[model samples]
Target: MIKTTRIPKLYVYQKVIIVFAALIIPVYFVNLLMNMKGQSFIKQEFSDSIQSKAQFYSNQLDDQISFIRNQQLQVVNDSDLQKLNFLSGTLDVFEEIQLVNRVKERLSTIQNSSDYLLNTGVYMKSFGRTISTQSGINKLPNQEYEIIGKLYSNSNKSSIYYQGGRLFFIEAANNSSVIVYLELSVKKLEKTLDQLVGNYGYSGAFITNEDFSYYISSKHDDSIVRKIQDNVSVEQSNKNDDSHILKFGDQSYRITYNHISTLGLSLYSYMNQNELTGSLKTFNIWLLVMSLVSVVIIIVFSFSVKLMIHNPLKELIAAFRTLETDNLDILIRPKNDIEFGYLYRSFDKMIDKLRQSIRQNYEQKMALQHSELKQLQSQIKPHFLYNGFFNIYMMCKAKDYETVATLAQKLGSYYQFVTRSGADEVPFDMEYRHAMDYVEIQRIRFSNRIHVVAGEIPDACKHLMVPRLILQPIIENTFEHAFENERKGGNIHITVTYEKKSLYICVEDDGNKLTDERLQALQKKLANCSIVLEKTGIINVCRRIQLEYGKPSGVFVSRSEHGGLKAEVIIHFNYGGGSDV
Candidate 1:
């Protein structure tokens, strides 16, 4: 009787429910996560829209500043203004007044055409005179002169600079002949900025000079501007795009900043986050309802699968459990469900047929067991007889009478031992003699090139039973494969020994053919007997011995002491204390 390992029992319905739970639990969590993630994505899109609006406002302000800078450049680069050379002192007072009037006319033309500029003027330090777009006598206030004088010393050909909270566009003549200034109105730009972003969400835009003196925007609160400035420094410097987020007074604002390099001004816009993601609560409620409905559907699907698949499978498995215990009398009744009805009927018919075939199968197994030895004998006998007869024919053709007679007699004795029909086991001495006959025949064929040596077997182990022809194929394998052209001294030695009720028969050769790796591989193959044993005659012999002695007995190969192949057989048996069994 064989003890079988028990399988952990599980019901089909329980397994199906377990699989459903495994699938549904992850889907439930994933659905909830997708709901949350979808809401987050919606919020992100809304925030991105706000940022886009902020960017739009920044671009509008940049355009306005660019327009103003272009106007200033046109006035600064006026060809008429460039031609006025004030260095010549030869002009009289009338000529000087004429020069100043001509400059004023050009300034008035510039100021009238530009909508953003409040006034355009030039202050001449070389003559200590100030000229404006106005047509009066060219006199200016002392306080105004003081401010313009300060601007004259520090201004360049760039955009308008702000000083004392007032906008001024100042440009010096190429020859330092005059410093041009355009005083811009902050109030007007503030109104324009309001109009630009007034229709958008809680949004405001501003333009500021680098010195923080002059600024124009819809709102004047410094906190929001400071937040924008602080966050923009980190975000805009690392990223080329001009959008960022700022938190001020428990409110979040998406701020965008754009730098107009031509005018040296920074444009900024701010928008509130609350206005962007306001409808998220409604979306979340809808997501919750959808998630609940999905869970209900999953529960219903799990129960439906249990009724449709699990119950029928459970009944089929219960019927098949009888086969596990060698009880084929059990039958599977046909199911009412069409899916399993045919399967159940077929299974019942199979069990009935299996019961009727049991006795016939037992008789067939007995016949197979009786034929296995005959098959083994048949596999080796014909091939061996053909080779033996061919060798005798060669000896006779060579007219070697002594060798022919000796080989013919040995061949007859070898076949007689191999063809013995009833017994599969032979005594150690008979097996050795059968192996020696084959080896001696080969020795005669090879003549002086081969040497064969047989050691004395122990008397106590002589009659111990071993599988037939086990040793002869091993000895024959050496002559067939192990010898090479380089090996002039081909030596074969057979030895038998006994220890602790186990017999070891080793056949070795000095052909120097078995390398260490080859020896290890052959030994491993013999040890792992799961392979097909029909490849070599020696392997078939090894598998036969293992099968006879309940798998603890088999042939093994190793490196010989003479630096060649060594084949070994380890067989375990009970000895009657110094007596042959």
Candidate 2:
């Protein structure tokens, strides 16, 4: 029986919910997406209809305005009006009076012909006199007279003006200084605007030119009108006639604007947003209710399944609990459920034998792994001793007593650290200091040929209890193998840093002469989880880190930024006891 680690996976009930959700979620979202798309189409169609209606009304008003303007033109050139103006001095007061009455009759006839017309006025420039159908034959220099004269000059050939809350059209005579002005019925224009927005729950419509000098409207809600003016920009309607939506007072509005080229004004049609999408909103609510029903069904089905499987699953859990207590000899009798009975019967045969084999195998395997880890850690004694004594012999032969003294001190301290027993983990600062001692020994041996750049241990990580002999072996491997053939420019650097619950140690070298294939092979050795069986110092350190911390906490090797080998060691403090280091 092989001992394997158990990773908690999804349970059957969880899978059931996931499967049902997977089946229902697409239909839910598909219906939602369809509703969204349909709302878009419906709004577009509604906007198109309003756009066409606006255009139709604008053209109709344009034709009416043009007809009124034409009638005013005809009266300007009428023979009776010409006599009333240039020939008024030659006629007697009675004859002039008859001419005035005749012109008044013509104006009255024109004003009464159209429902949109208000009143017409004739300015008699030659005598400073004016005549009108509303206030017939008023004397010269009156308020209406002065207003007509001012309006005639300020019309600026634009043919129209607004004053005193009324829209007016002014046309001058062809052969005289006389002018004829027409006042359009603002009330009538307001009625047209009102008709455009008839019966809306909350709505308004209005007509405005570039001047906005006169906004003809049926309602007097200034706030809504001002909001519409600010939010709706109709300058782009010549290119695309898409209507816009506006939010006001907890209500959304659909606003449409169409430019009237003939009258030089724009008509804006406003209505409640829900007025157009009431049906779709109802449909969306229905879909939401149905989707909730589906979720409720799924939840109810999950409870039903739990109830159906609860007893059998309880029995199976009890059986597993007996195994948990190492009571594998406690056999579970078959239950009434056929499938569960089959499982119980099958497991009963294997439980006892499996229990005995697993206990023996697990104990042996753990003992072998722990023994291998200890051997790797303690193997530092023999190889390091041989090297230390040989280096001391070389210094003695060179007659360098000063160098010999320094080497002896470093060697004694380095061995004193490695030869200690019982403590498998030491403070990180101790490990760091011991690793430095090994580097100092190498420094004395190689003299000016090796430059080891090392950083101080961070204060926060100094108290961490880490596995013994972890950092020294990697540094030794670097010095022994990487700088083996190099005589100059040999460099070694070690660093320490921590993130969250993890400690990172990186050792790098610049004197490495490793080929790509050999480097790759070495990297693969460090990454492999199985015991390497090879007793190389770097590989042993890699295995030791893996044994202490679990997966994803180990040694990794890559090419360094300095064109050499870089080895990184990662240990998780959660697994490697934080208090112990």
Candidate 3:
């Protein structure tokens, strides 16, 4: 009896669920992580875009400030200012007036060319006289006079100042104790800021100095600016600013600041977090919907598997279960699904084939038993047993005790080998000894009329298991058929050798009983396997070899160098065993 180990098993529906979860869970997590990464990327891109635009606006403001400075330079280098030189007493009243008119007209031209300029004027510090494009020859108050002079003395060549919502560039006139000023408006600055903040709903303020006093701003709620004022630390305001995100109240803001160093002003933009991540939120929603839809699809697929595969396979398994009771009379019902229908049909057909094979095996067993009985009956004839005893008795009467004992021992071994019903295969040495015994008995019977020669059988080959009586039948054929006419000088030679992963057993006889046609017919019969079982004697041995080691290791017949028949039995070392029955 054999014992088999049991293995853990998963049902079809369980496997389906496991496989679906295995595939879906990873995809869900991967999609979630990808969405998170995408949101981060979007935020970074928005940050970079806003910073770049803010820098652009800062550069534009710098250029405008540079334009005002250049205008001041033009005024200081004016030839009319050099010719007038308010302190010079060389000019008459009319000439001095004309000089001042020339300077005002030039200043008018310089102010009119720039879109952002509000006013341009020249103020004389030595005489307390002011000439302007906006106001005509106004004398400053004693207090204003001291302030303006101080402002002029302290100004390092040129400087910008913001007073009462007005931006100005002031410079000293060349070669004269005079001050020149140009005031700028906010129209162009507002338009540029609108362009930058239009796409996203971002609002900001422009601060001229570090103080949160007076500033220019777009139309935004006052609370937002107040929130920024309350939250922006002194360190954050004064430092070389980098873009950042901030949380104020219940809302989040992306805060960025760009500073124009020349004007001592900074532009601060505040973007709502919701607006910046709106698209990414939409993407996350879409991904979530797809995940839900995937789960629904998996559920539907699992249900389909239960209907189409699991149920049908269950029926097939139940049908196979009947086989445990040695029942082959199972009728598997057909399925509506085409694949399962075909499977059910094939399974039914296989069962039918198994039943037919079982019946045929029973009949073959009966036939084999009948054939074995007939063979035993033929082998154990009264004449063979009586002749063997009589020969022994004569040997004993002639006082040949040793020869008699040897003959009796050979006879016992031959009968013992022939009568074996348990094993189909025996070791090569045992078969070799049995064949030698048969040959010895033949030699005793034929006397000097026949001879037997067996070549050296290597020790390595003596242990190989070959079919019992595989060799004896060939030697028996030589006496029965080969030397049927004459026995004198009859020769039998045997050789065994191994080569090319196969063992070859050769038996040759010197008796020339077969003609060319008969030898050819015998060779053809040995090679043809369809009629192998119909053959007797040597052909039967050839068939047994074919059955044992397959066709490549079957017997071959040829004309021997001894001028007679040679039968070679080929057996492979790798041939598997066969049933004795």
Candidate 4:
């Protein structure tokens, strides 16, 4: 051999299988436990939802059956059936039978008679005639004949009892001697079972009489129905529970039996274990796939941990150094080896984390700046107070004693209302008064150049809660911006309306034309402001609304039809009363 080099057999022969098994075993068990828990939750939820729907449908069916029975009894109590029964003349027997047949056909034609999960029929004891919607007119067999006679004997009360493989019912109206027999249909009952199975994903079955001779099944074998019938009888004999789950072989089934006292028939619901767990099937498949993937990922992760952890730290440090120098464009892609592949992933994760941290810091800074701006804007209220004082000073200097006295009283009351506030929310009546006072002060300053016309606040909404000073600011803005250029005949209209769920206040002015540029600028300024101009008196009402009620509840501004600006503020009533702006 040329240079005779031997490869190390230890590396190739190492027990990787043992290492993989040790890692995967615990993971598989954990996955199984999680799957079982999740499946149980889904199955319980599905069962509850379906159970509610089934009970609803069952109640509807019972109502429909009761309605049809009532209608049939009413027909017996009517004139037609009585006339057919109580004829006194010497009548041909065959002709009388033909007349009875016509009457029976007419009653069968009633709408919804076929919809009942039972066969409806009329049995006449007088003519020995039994007219069934299912079997047509025929002479009743001796046994049915005897049963019908017994029913007619006890006709004072409506009778419901079972015989043969069917439920039988007879009701005789006091006005007529006609006897009606209603037979429950097995096929219709089976259809109801199918509907329940389709809706709830559970199989069901029913049996009639104590012997369990007549039976219906829903996807289960006839033997299972028979076995359940036997068990139900034994339980009833022992006076035990009527519902229980039976496991036969690998399958499990839940059986619930109810003895319908009116018809003497046993109604039941059968549920399969697999059907109950049907919703869990998809989750189990996904759990299995994830378990397999987890094992492979763990192996790869363990192999590259040491190398991957070190290189990424180095690259991240270099990137951070560049970032310190304000170079945000540094790339940190690792090599293509297994260890470096993991390193690249770690670097990508670090970059995402850093980006998130930076975004969070920026948001916090913006919030702080916004808070400061709001504090500054709230100082505008004091400026308005000072302006009111200035008006009072001028009134006194003019030597008009009556005017000065009246203005001073109004100013005192306005300041009292503004400064004496404890809670931010006030009654609509009080808020309205505050707005009127502000407008009155503005009227004194502007004289007859500005006129404020406010509509009557409804007594129903008077007690409704509203933010303090909500309407005053909009009124102030109308006078300050809208009527600033108007010489005379400027009108400000304020209307309050109460809707079903919300209160609306509309303030419109007929002063100056609101230009598109001003509207755009106002929108931009309101958007940038920390507190909404709509929430605060002049500068921050919109921002306060955004903070308090969020974006959906805020101030909206537009040009009124009167060729001036309109400011609309919407306040929604909350549980603690009206929400803060």
Candidate 5:
């Protein structure tokens, strides 16, 4: 053996270098391959997007051409153009031109500027008479003679033909009297096509006739023209193949063809492959750099994995162990390393889960309490119904026919108020009416022994929303508790007033003073801590207000200034002067 020491440092260096090279090399090549694949995918996707856009534009253009043609046919059938042609005695060309100008102006107003069409004109076969304001007298074609002859032979059907290198003839209703043509300029159409191509990063466009004899190119490329013309034998053949990618003179391109039958032309949009792959190339360069960086990070982290990951995990485990013995207030601290930060966050999430569990438990308990409270409320309604029906039965049994009839009617009305259909909210005036009805019935029972006083309730509060039967129970409680056994005259006063986000209803009775124990018991019931169902009318009122309007409402019982029991109900009023209770 050649001088072997305790630990071999060269082995460690060799392993590190080997690991570094192994990580970086694959990262570079894999990044390059991925870049190429991504670029190819992007190019194909971009070409497809462009092809779809061209096809949509082509269809729209075709519809516009057909619409213009139909409109021209209607103009040709117009009796005015025929009348102008049939008129004798030295034709007034000036007035006729003026009328044509007016018609052209009106048509121009309706046609979109991007549509590439001009005015509809009438051409007469006899004497080569033409009425066109779009084409001036100087711009009139000398070939108008042959064009009119062709018009008379074709009759009143629509046809399309190219003329004068700049204009497209959209001829409709070619008859003996007139040939109506909607002139669309090729320059405008070319501009529109160019705009469409530019929007989709396309380089050029080519338009060809049905027979492929004539063609116009946006880029003036003769090779593209020859290639497309040779490939498409007929107009129908153009529709068979919509898209293709071709290589032309060291450049790759994607061409999408749309056959427009309405205009008798085929549109081909040629896009450069470079434009589609441009963004992909940028993304590949970024990905290559990122991948290389990731590989370096992975290798560095692999060797340092124990120091970076294991130490923090141990610390987190120790902190978690402490949680078993300690309260929920245990604090966890992680190391400065990024890998350790992740573990720290995980620990924090665990603690958060524990806290959330405790909160959920509390919420469940509260929900159970709420459910029990609702069941109690449901029971109260049936109890009231039973008592009301029993009272009616007793009156009927006593054979007091008049009192039974009146009481039955009042009871029916009271039940109707209690069990009214619709929303939970009722008008404040309705609640007041119900309270007054209950007091009237109590007045009959108590005779002149009880005196009731109600203050002026505002008309504006008539439509203001409040809970049904909210005030009635409080007033009924006053009569039952204060005036029930009082021999002397008892007075009950009801006053309602609005005071800054709350509605205050004061029900005071001048009767026997309540002992401190009774007052405390009443307060407990109002606060919802007491479970006395018989005394729950006040509790029901409090609970309903709390449920409907939340914590801002309840009943308050104290000694009255008039030397008796005084009950005050505070209900929260919402923003629109309506009691949520």
Candidate 6:
């Protein structure tokens, strides 16, 4: 026995519930899309907010630096400042002192203009004199003069440069060999750094020179400054003031930087990313909770729909599957709404009518087929009996006792087989025995003028039950027509073979009496489905076999290999022990 894999069965209700569950997936997909889009927007807005702070601090520093440079420009053009630098080595002490006092007053007015300006002074290289404000009319130390001395060598126009760990503005007085220097207040710049970071936790801001050689930060922690120095690059910050997110240690920070062109430095600020986007996290948590609740509600509602709708339709679908197995006895009760109840009752009534119609149809067909067999069998008996009696009478007139006795014996045995008390269908062995008896009687009647080539049925095919007398009429027709008008060289060949699931009873002769055209006409007649005919011949035998075995079992008539008609009665049957009864 071959084992078959059985598929797991799902009812209509369960499948519908699965479809309902599938509908919930897009809601989750939409939530994912929302979070993705929301995160991008939050990061962009946070970057913009921090960038604005960076720009705000940068503008303030630029404005203050510009004003100080403008004041230095004003002081460089003053007459007292000019004469003091040009003729300092030639002046009397009292006269030089008064002129220096007047220049000191002008410098004092410029220094007091901004809170971030710590000091302002001018150094004259031609007179070897340093002028006052912080230290009036004194020759300063060489280290202090190194910045003004070396910075003025490469600059004449008012320009800003970073040097000696401080920011300065240097400008040379035209043709006067005088240089001015201004220093920014470190403590006040630190205050600006504090405002740049605002109120953000885990945040800081810094100012670094273009060379990255020195820096000032809101928190003067050296480790963090070094960490920022090691991990971050501030090179492109001078080109544009864009914001970035950077990770340092275990924390992520949103960093913003801008180049201060006036000061020749870049300003950097940072805040923790979590602190910047904390509100978005809260919004996502609430959204997830709400979406989960909606999913649960959908699942509960789908089960309820299964109970009200899918359950009713599930029964209808089950009834149809049962019908596929030819089981029409399934009962569906009217326990649902009127629409479903009406359908259930209709199915019940339809099954009852279907069963009744099948019963009537089957009985009528069986009775009619049995009657057709009996009538065909009866029709064969009378015509063959008349021929047998006529041949015996002619032999009696000729007084051929031996041949008549043999023919009579075969004729009697043929009748006994036709009159056998059993079903109209009999085994192949019995049918073959009956056909041989008829062939023997005809052999004796034709004597030396004819020869019959034949053999017994194969042992494998001896037990297939077939319609009675299916072979006799074909042989009888071969004799009555093929051997008519005394055609010589008469030979008859009968063969029984089994192939596939069918038995072939072929009776061929060499009489040459039937033309190819006549054989064609007979083949078409034999294949015709209308089998009820008033003749006991080749067509009749074909009809009986078709009625018994249905499709693929019929008489096929063709020109035989021996140049005569070949009548083949093919019957299909199943192979089993003792054949199909």
| Predicted model with the maximum lDDT | 2
Top candidate when judged by TM-score against the true structure: 3
Q: Note the Cα lDDT for every prediction shown.
A: 0.71, 0.78, 0.74, 0.65, 0.66, 0.76
Per-residue lDDT over 423-529 for candidate 2, one digit per residue giving the tens place of the 0 to 100 score: 67789999999999999988876765888888887888898887788888888878877886677758888889987878899999886586799889998788784
Question: lDDT tens digits, residues 382-441, model 6?
Answer: 666787898899988999988889888888888888766668777878878888888888
Task: Please give the lDDT score for candidate 1.
Answer: 0.71
Which is better, 1 or 2, measured by lDDT?
Answer: 2
Q: Give per-residue CA lDDT, model 1, range 1-581, as digits (tens).
A: 99999998876667776777788778878877887898789878866765676567556656665666566567567654544444435567776667666777877776876666787777555555666764333544455666877766666645556776577767666665666777777777788777655565677888876545556776745777776666655765565766666778788876766666655777776767776666667777876787788778877877887887788887888888878899887877774758788789878877775676575564563354345556656766465577778888887899988888998999888778877786666788898889888887777666658888887789988888766777887887888777635447578888889988888889888886667887777777777654664545666667666655546777887778887888888777642111237
TM-score of 1: 0.44
Query: Cα lDDT for residue 6, model 2?
Result: 100
What does candidate 5's lDDT look like per residue over 45-118, in tens digits? 78778888898889888887777766666666666555555562246878767655655554454354435675
Clashing pairs in 1: none
Off by over 4 Å in 3: 1-9, 86-114, 124-158, 174-176, 199-202, 230-233, 236-241, 356-581
Q: Which lDDT tens digits does candidate 4 get at residues 1-581? A: 57977985432113344465677888788879878887877766655545554555556655666666676667667555566666613467776766776667656764346564355666555555666666666775655556666655654454655444455567765443467666666566667767766754446655456677665544456767766766875668753454566876688776655555434455666678787886678887888798778778766755554345544555666777887886656566766666656656655675675677587764674464355344533545676678777877887888767866767777887777766626555788998987787777778877657878887898778887665666776787888787766676588888998776567889998766679899777766665656434434544665554444445555677778888888888766542224333
Q: Work out how many backbone clashes candidate 2 has.
A: 4
The clash tally of candidate 6 reads 0
lDDT of 3 by residue, 1-29 (tens): 89999987989887988888899999888
Error of 6 at 150 (Å): 11
When summed lDDT is taken over every stretch of 10 residues in candidate 3, the lowest stretch is: 369-378
Q: Give per-model TM-scores.
A: 0.44, 0.43, 0.54, 0.41, 0.42, 0.44
RMSD of each: 19.1, 15.3, 20.4, 19.2, 19.1, 23.3
